[model samples]
Target: MDELKIPNVVCKIEVYAAVNPSEDPDKVRLAVSHVILETDYQYKEGSIKATSNQLNSLVKIQETIKKHRTNKIYRRQMRFNTKGDTTWFYLNKQAAFVDVIAACEEAEESAMGPIKVILHSKDLDKVVDWLAPEMTE
Candidate 1:
């Protein structure tokens, strides 16, 4: 696979996960970390929130989408969830824990709850294209 070009845009990316009584906080943090690079994590009442203002944070997700040939799925999710300058998607928590980036169409798809990733940007279309381009054979 060739190198992916990270979009140059001012955006705020946040990954959130609810920490259930049966789940370990550290494991939740690890899951979020695997998805977003160098995330600044914040722990609150039964929840974990991580934030990043750089497009580089999405590099791993971009690579995973290409590697798994899931670009259309991610692009659809992102566009479908778009509202104003923000769009969000869900990821399977268990898949993320093991360093696999999996996009979920709904939160209930993941047995242990899903990781919610939100993106806010004025240039949302550019960001989405960079993250998951329309692949052509």
Candidate 2:
């Protein structure tokens, strides 16, 4: 995808899930807040099922990844959800936050499931680098 058309700000991107049409916004936002806090999301029994791309959370994520950009990193796609009003691509949380400094080399994969990182075609590189930087010595 062309990288020139992607958005740098998190609010500009979008995400969705197969949530009940009658789901409450406050509930959804609250559920999303949990994911944002833990830096991961997973559907459990009776757990809130919602789709979100909350702006402040996303901005904090962007900043956190930038803060850890200098460390050795791994980037892996956790899952590929179907597209609706928005295209959603989930990523491993370790790719965005954890530092596997004991690996001796960059980890090729991660088990930190369900942290979604929304990427635009135009700004793909910027986003990837933000989350998992391709650095040099």
TM-score of each: 0.96, 0.36
Q: Number of clashes in every candidate structure?
A: 0, 4
Q: Rate the local accuracy (lDDT) of all candidates.
A: 0.92, 0.38
lDDT of 2: 0.38
Look at candidate 1 and give me any clashing residue pairs: none
Task: Report the C-alpha lDDT of model 1 over 19-92, residue by residue, as the tens digit.
Answer: 99999999999999999997799999999999999999888998898888899999999989999999999999
Best by TM-score: 1
Compared with the true structure, model 2 gives a TM-score of 0.36
Any idea how many clashes model 1 has? Answer: 0
Q: What lDDT score goes with residue 48 in model 1?
A: 94
